[model samples]
Target chain A: MGGLTVNTKLLRQILVGFVRDEVYKVGVRKGVLGLSGGIDSALVAYIAAEALGPENVHAYCMPYRTSNPESEAHARLVAESLGIKFKVIEITPMIDAYFTLTPDADNMRRGNKMARERMTILYDHSAAVGGLVLGTSNKTELLLGYGTLHGDMASALNPIGDIYKSQVWALSEAMGVPSEVIEKKPSADLWAGQTDEQELGFTYREADELLYRMVDQRMSREELVAAGFDAAFIDNVARKVQGSHFKRRLPIIAKVSNRTIDRDFRYARDWGK
Target chain B: MDFTVALAQIKPKLGCLDDNMALAEAAIEKGIAAGADLVVFPELALTGYFLKDLVPEVALRLDSPQMEKLKKLSERISIAIGFVEVSADYRFFNSAVYLEAGEIRHVHRKVYLPTYGLFDEQRYMARGERFRAFDTRFGRIGMLICEDMWHLSAPYILAMDGAMTLICLSSSPGRGVTESEGLGSAAAWQKLTTTTAMFLNCRVFYCNRVGYEDGINFWGGSEAISPSGEMTDRGAILEEDFVLAKVDGGALRRERIFSPMMRDENLAITVKELKRIDREKDC
Candidate 1:
């Protein structure tokens, strides 16, 4: 189902170079990131270690008590494999402490709360190490809006944000990530049985091919259906893309003044002046 | 006369005019030290590409001190460069310039402002209007800034105007890593330049920038193509590289005499057909 193949060798070079240059440009040669042990985080950990030397890469594995133990093991595996700086901070106490006040929290709320807690820890660790927070969200989750805003989505830079999840496996393999980590079922590990596919209602392979055609190729809905995509699947995917539009952009600022912050007063994140 | 030209595949500091100028000065000095006749820089070489709202901030008037400083360097060896140009009317243009003997030889404002897909050039800057070749100490040559050369008419117009050398200054971004070959955008550019060189019977020296800006990356595969469509030299892809290639007048003359495509060009018929197409567009 995943026909989108990239030149792994060249892609690795470009991504590694991107991380190296971007991290150094922002006045730091170091990068800090939350390593979830999923393919996305494992892949980013590998790239960050390669870009800034392993010594400069600080990886945090913040897992809730409910998170599968394998998640922590694989996270440790990736960190040890890369020889990057590693830490494991159990997120249960902070998350449970907050939820103890608000006992009516559902699965979605707990998951989001844990994600944001990990984000705060990463930022705090970033300041501790004087490094930028590296983002781990891939294109699939980003486009689907499956990530928690200001939580897992927050980062100073993301080398893999543009890469699709379907492609992340291949990139992870190419970069020598442990096979077990790459081959595992895609999961957020928020709960005992939680997997991304169970929640998203579709595999990444299906979504990637569909999104490649629907977005990159700019195929119309009629054309997509005619090309053999199920109407319901197409509808579901398109809605998520549309629904998550705000997640991909800066917050909207009302134009009370002539030049708004992001509206008309736009400057690049790498602005030299 | 045969002469050496240095393709300075530079990486510009985004919106930092002084830092970029230092880069330009260093490259120019290296070119002179190498005994090259000319040094070519990429589009907006003094100010990095993707300067969305920072256009006016980095733009320089033709008579600005920065322009004068670069002009004075041309006394040793001719220079071809790209920058944001501000007109007396206060409109900014993506412009390429040729400098020789401490004087500005010619300035070509980029004609086609690409506003599609990943590019949004038309949003912030004014588009250039025409393609006109000009004379330098070397010979008659034309300048194309990135997309200007994408349209067939841009290079064709210059060749028909008696220019035998076409210099393209580019800040092309790297994309499409899935192509069977190398980068998809790079392959497209290579095909474009190789065919243009063969058809126009001219020397095509392309200098493209390297470096990353925000999330975008510029691929730097600067090249020199001979009239016979032979790739004489090419800079490293996706990295900073300074490569030198020779411009042999004898080679150009021989290729033109052998191919004779430029010799047999029927501009009158082309003009008539263009006029007819223009008239039909109004229908």
Candidate 2:
């Protein structure tokens, strides 16, 4: 089966062009991206470097106490290999300080804080360096509602988002990312020993295959199951995709006018060129 | 020169900037395979339209490093796409970026901010103040957002600025309307497109988004019109696909010669003055 092969070279060029064009047009030169040490961030860093050059790409590793040390090392390794500037800021003390102040914070709330903390750091650096935060999440993560809003999901521009986990591996390999980074078990490193498959209860290969069939192909449950996917797995994935749909869209505004932005306010980017 | 353009009708996940760019790349590849010299995508194609609060967070500055990828993609074919452009002062506007020959040729921000109904654009997007046409290899082309087509001044400004072709990118919702409504709506939309083509004595290209996101379904009715006020080519509505059409730039000159609409100063002057008065009133 010839699945949609994301052209990594093309993808990198496109990302680089996106950043460089925006920078050249608007006159901003630097950029920042959260370095999670996962395949997503690894790929994003490489693309940003290609787009803005290593001198311009700033990779920040915001690790909490709960975050695995291995992931931090991996993030550093990727940043160093690419010759991009890197920084490691531990979020444990800050997260602890916030929790100390708001003791009622639950896991979900704390997770959100962690995500937001990373964003604050990225944006602050962005201001100081005149850069935009590049996003690192993938389509699978976005569809699964796997990321915290305004946290890991935040970015001024994302280059690898369309690539599924499986496809990210393909592109990472093409971009010469180390096998260790590409082949490692996927995790957000949000907590110690927190593998993405373990927490989500599905492997990237399985999830991406299912998602490719469902989203890219728009196959129904019966069709997917008939193709030999487990019925429960299909339902679970579908439910996740459905549940997290809101995160994938703009806030619905009630239409009450002659020309709505998403409706009638249509114009080409180079309409008057 | 005859310009063959493709309007890519795609479904983009909001906030999924990378994926949206990938989709755009795929669309361009398709367009190139079909021999298109330029490809146009829906407004905010990179970041996805309808990003409410996320617009500020995800909005890209016009000169952000993210657009380098698109610029490289333009090495072979010209591309135009829309995104949330944040300025130096942190004000955000809905803007389009034009890429050709490995460079960003121009950036046009949407001027009209629709606040009512399903649009809180005014809440998040700052209105654009400038309107002008740019010179391209194809010809002098004009750009506008979806709602900009409704205003008489947008096309007028482009024409006054000496545009020979007008292109509009849109993400118009279907709004639970029926087929009959769509037919009527299409007629109305076609009238607007044709009117602009006729008024400017220039060809027009309009592309719309197609797909259901939340409750708002984007009805894709991408089309291309000749200067003679004829729908030369149109894309499918409410579907994910692209429309390819060959437009003869020479046809504009020929059509203008045949129709003499460009020389009709009586009504054109009044319309231009009325638009100027309205713009002055707003100021």
Candidate 3:
């Protein structure tokens, strides 16, 4: 039902301006991103380079010992092509030190730990280089709560958060990202032989259309089914989108006063005057 | 004379008067550079909408220094903008002003203070009673603030009072989505503006702001409609635009002669009917 496509040239200009303005408003022109060599990170890196010049953009390839080598190479390729600084930081030692204590740690725990650790590394690099952390999470992953909270989702600012995964692929191709990075199977690389589609049970194209109709179009489950979507599929996507709602917002503060921080004192992102 | 209006759909920071005025002045300069005869801003463009308790703090008197700066800008071109008006009685009104040649030409206080839904305007601001049109160098123009135009009678009264150009400043949030129409609010507003133009035989300028403020987002689909029920030009949706469009007085005259809706309207009969209904309602 959703056949939406973005004009890459126009989108590039808009996003580049968004990045520049949002960054400049905060009195900073430098940006740092945790590059996983996936389409999302690759796209963000390219845009950041375009917005803040290649000299001001920095990319870090934080991989675990068991992480795929292809991912690290792809991340390097992105940095090299954009003429931005690239660094490789292995999270194997840091992750294993904690996991060694908990012998029964599951794959989820390990993945979450890795995600948070990578964020820690990115933030540290951001401070060292005087750059803000650029978010790479797309709208589909953000809505579905696919990324770990406060881990992969943590950022000073996000340029592609409103874009869907399917749209991200299209934008990536249009932005001239490497063909290998665009064609590769999407993955979090939490463990060996792990892939995103296998874990989610549906391809991004299918889920993206479902999300576009449900969220953007505001179609109900019944309406979606009547429009020819599988009832169960629609229900599943709805549940995921609903369940992940908390990840999209700030932590709720108990409001005992008239001007509670996030409650009554909520202001625009650039309220510092 | 054919007048060109610069419909500036901009987002102003809430409770930040200095910044908002600076932005307004910049837009005015840009519009002047674009050869516009008049420039229009969104409702409460100076103080921002949803002020709540901050209304009185940010409210400006007609002689306030901020308004003096705005008046100085109007020395170059006609300026139409919205702000909270602090009266001599110390009451505030959600108001729009038409400033020209370093003077306050006209002001229209918002008659309808929408209290229900997301708006709490009635809680903080007093309602205005009069709807008047005033003469400018370009033409006789009327100003309505946001919800005032939502009520049909506001524009109708202005049209009857000899306003040939209707300027509406709105801070309306985007809501509702149907398959046929992308944004329901935008579609509804388009119909309202175009119908008002066709029925009143006047040019309509609808200026809406864009940006997120306190959770509610103002969708900017500002447009200029001709007297012939045609959308002459429109601004970008959810983006800032400083665009100018020509309004032909000749076309307006031709449309008035062709349709003659205003000429055919029997105001005395309608007033008599309304008065009789009021009297007979006791039965």
Candidate 4:
């Protein structure tokens, strides 16, 4: 979108390098990334495989009754293509049992339940296997408040949190993901006929381009509109980025002392005697 | 002569060359009004620190036209400022240039290149190997960069090399922590200043930068610590201002004579020998 500013291949290499170094530093032998049949998760699985090795990467596919069958099949195909260990678990029973115990559970409640359930399964499997849970949400989703908080957004470390969705597609192509996964209508597939563009009211290309110009380039709204983007589109994307700033930061805690955690407690991540 | 030192905890605009020079001029006027004999600014006060690759472009040659303007300003009051100094060979140094009576008296390049997180000084600056004390009318002053104060050897070496007072310029970032947190950068600053003063048994004038550049925010908490490790004056955190304090050369002499840490050659040898012993044990 708008002539990809960041090189996807280089971004992938950097992320893979960071992941590999972090794993080695922490002394973790394996890593698990959720394969959600979405391009982001699929790309993450591939990158994690490249970083930690196919044998060390475990791809978990959690499907509910509402989940499309083709989505599950595609996820399995991605895992197989990467030669990674794939596990399929049905979440319908878990959702049904929980809903039955608590009637009148709305869409918001159910959506949150599904997200937490998936994370619980991922973390449990990660703990059992002694691997870190890799995050799949990209920068676009993170910036626009598109991710389920503490659900898909939760991970031991995120490799693709800085890459936008358009960049994710470019990386997917470089990753040798199936063209279907790349070219297919982008979706979370939470419901039938659901697409991310249709829900967000803007295409990933537009959103990614606008977000890149806003965040990375730090361009003004007038500059963006002058650059040939619609004024309304610029306003909408700016609002989304501003509105979702909380998702990107740590919760601010009040300081009653001479030094605070975020301020004083900074040593280098690798700082040691 | 009665000496008053002003530590200018000023924020420098990153990459805005003209605006930064203007700010430096205004800060000098403020120091002169305060009747300060010497005004000390933070490290990289002229162009700003934490610049990724723009150091070479923004760095000034020692005898550049910009230094002439600073030299003119120095005629009013003795000025100590930090900036990137480009050598004839084109090597860049994080140097502290001291100007008095319209001439640069001494230029000290930083030796400690912090190559750790959020810092890539090693990539940009060549380390200075020699440590020397500057003879000033006020006292025998020594200059050091931010991380140089962290090592016990730096202040001790400066003192043994004939420095009666140590002046350290720092651009220490406000590592994402609140003022109340005991583990933050402010606490680290206090510990470093106190420990260095105690070890050297000399007064220390520490000047730190303020404001955010890139992802790191510099917390300006300049302070003057006496030889007894007491803070005589402390500047406000995250604000730009100057702190003026009178240095009692007699009190400093008394503290050193009472403690005798500076004159204890046997103690210094024992410490060095212990370190060598520890290294041999590890081997």
The best candidate by TM-score is: 1
Residue range B125-215, candidate 4, lDDT tens digits: 8888877898887778899899998877788778888887899999997642221333267788898898788877878899998765532
- Give DockQ for candidates 1 onward, in order: 0.62, 0.01, 0.10, 0.02
Write down the worst ten-residue block by lDDT for model 1 chain B.
B176-185
Question: What digit string (tens of lDDT, one per residue) describes model 2 on residues A1-273?
Answer: 346455454445445555565454345787798888888889888878887889998899999988888888999999999999999998889899879988987777888899999999999999988887888888889989899877888876666676687777877898888789998898776667768899999897889888988987889888998999999999898899899888776577788998786665554231211
Score every model by TM-score: 0.98, 0.51, 0.82, 0.53
DockQ of 2: 0.01
Give the distance in Å from residue A68's predicted Cα in candidate 4 to where it truly belongs.
Answer: 26
Ordering by lDDT: 1, 3, 4, 2
Q: In model 3, which runs have C-alpha deviations exceeding 4 angstroms?
A: A3-14, B2-15, B26-37, B47-57, B72-76, B86-94, B110-132, B145-157, B170-196, B206-225, B229-248, B265-283
lDDT of each: 0.92, 0.80, 0.86, 0.81
Which is better, 1 or 2, measured by TM-score?
1
DockQ, 0 to 1 scale, candidate 4? 0.02
Candidates 2 and 3: which is better by DockQ? Answer: 3
- Winner by lDDT: 1
Candidate 2 Cα misplacement greater than 4 A, ranges: A253-273, B1-283
Clashes of 3: 0
Candidate 3 structure quality by residue, lDDT tens digits, B1-283:
8878999999887778988998899999998998899999999998777677678888999999999998999999999999999999999999999999999999889999999877778878999989999999977889988888889888998888889889999998865422333466788899999998888988999999976553345778899999877998999976788768987869988988899998888889878998999999998
Best by DockQ: 1
- Distance from true position, residue B172, model 1, in Å? 0.6
Candidate 2 residue-wise lDDT at A77: 94
